[model samples]
Target: MPKLNYETVRYGDDPQVGASNAKQIFLLEELLRAIALQGYSFTTVTPLTHQRFLLGFDGLAKNTRDIFGWNLPFKATILPPYIFKIMTEADLLFNGGDCFRSKIRISSLGEDLFLHSHFPTNDSHAVFFGPDTYRFARFVRHSLRLFQLQSGFADRSIPIRVLDVGCGSGAGGIAVIRSLPIHQLYELNLNDLNFAALEYARVCANVAGIPVNVLHGDFFNIKNSQFDLIVSNPPYLNDPAARLYRDGGSLLGLELSLRIARHALGLLAPGGRFLLYTGMAITSDDNNPLLSELLPYLANDKFQWTYDEIDPDIFGEELKQSNYQNANRIAAVGLTVMRIT
Candidate 1:
């Protein structure tokens, strides 16, 4: 993997991109400010209406057009009251302590979405869902478009079965479900090592009316599942120590991913596709051993593989260090698609 030059990245300066990012930040700030000024008045009486108003103020409703090319399928609904209470308490705790930053923003491109900064949480190193969710969604959507084109089903219904591993907040899974035509999804499986995330995914699935089979266990331990499409936005942080949410495994950052890929090969039905979004450490060592190591495991007689976006620098050294990877060393974030024959 080579270093990513943010300056040359294509999506950086588009006006709509800038506005979308700004609006999310503004929305979070406004929410906080409103709470400070009115002591949760907005949340107390008519929380559903209040949330819609705030979403409008932040341009979220309008941005739906940019994301889906039309109105969002469902109206904005208030998070359940208990969830709201938990968020309020969490907000208070974060405000009083230095765990969370003063400002945070939401960013989304298509089905991918993320919060700007990492939040302090027990399960993962960085706070909030990282940018991986957005990146994964984009890649999967692109793959689907390619599939449609190649199969001459560009305008026809092509049902797909998808699997989401380590699905946190269920955002990545939700993104895929929302992008495709409903009822075209034959089977959707959401898996996470974290019990909390799995529970959250279940709640989200129910609320969205997207039926999913939720598995609360390690990705490496899954069995008896075959699907047409497998998608994952896995944790690839090169942390030596085990963190339930983000650290994949001990063999640098590739152990968990390797295990998942191996299992995915077994689980993919004939002519099925596996799409993954993950980061890999690219070092100065001779021959770039990582890719070769993966080739044997990721490539097989039956699958054709394509890897893109070799490397894209996302953050500075200090941030990377805290998250457990070598900040100065280059790494690659890739969209890898493998077709099983």
Candidate 2:
């Protein structure tokens, strides 16, 4: 992936081509902010459930919330003229017959509104934000609270530096940044292999006024950088299409999660923490195979490791696929490891 030139990114001063793209992103952010101010709040649901809900509405969108929030299509006449104008100028709307749909989806997280790929996100570079995003936000808040409660974090010389691995929509880390007090300043890195995802992340971080260093590549490509915190909400499903955002590879979906945990350990500074929120596949023979494999890696006494099954069963629909035929079920799991020196 070609690197986005940092020097050419001064929107107000530079006439660079990238600046034009940046300007469009700014407009998109402004549009979303305005929508949020209008009390527009939505929580994204699963694609399956979203489809079912769309059916209940007779497949015709009634208002802005129906078109944008429910990811449904709406006739242009039904749209609020001003909102439609902004969507058109912001390049956020698509024509569906006489109806128009948003190119992106907006969801609310507290006071902030997050932008992500539109409904039925089947594209290779889809930026996903949904229920798991909420869970990851909770996990990050808890981890930061734990860090503050522990010793060594009190050292003012050390600022809170975080590396968000596979930051799909940059929601996990930016949410933390927004939650932290202004006095507790921090720098963050958003890492993702998907170029589109990184672009969306940059826009999200910019909208939040968060200072983010966007790293475009696989998480393992990361090196020579130690962070006070490393967090990941990695994709853990064995998709037949091997989608960049969803496929977890051939190990019954644990491949990418394990790989991230291994490399992330080296990137954690002393007293630093790693929080991995992912799904684990439990087979017929072994109940916690993923944890068993990960335990040996964190066996050292210096590391405080804890694993919790946040949800014992999720994505039961995945079991119908051949990749998960032998697997009993996929469970939502959280792995927290802190390097204490």
Q: List lDDT for all candidates, in order.
A: 0.52, 0.79
The clash count of every prediction, one per candidate, is 3, 0
What is the total number of backbone clashes in candidate 2?
A: 0
TM-scores, each model vs. reference: 0.62, 0.90
TM-score of 1: 0.62
Candidate 2 local lDDT, residue 33: 64
The runs of at least 3 residues in candidate 2 whose Cα sits more than 4 Å from the true structure, single-residue gaps closed, are 1-17, 78-82, 154-157
Pick out the ten consecutive residues of candidate 1 with the lowest summed lDDT.
Answer: 1-10
Clashing pairs in 1: 112-134, 118-127, 119-127
Superposed Cα deviation of residue 214, candidate 2 (Å): 1.6
Worst 10 residues of 2 by lDDT: 1-10
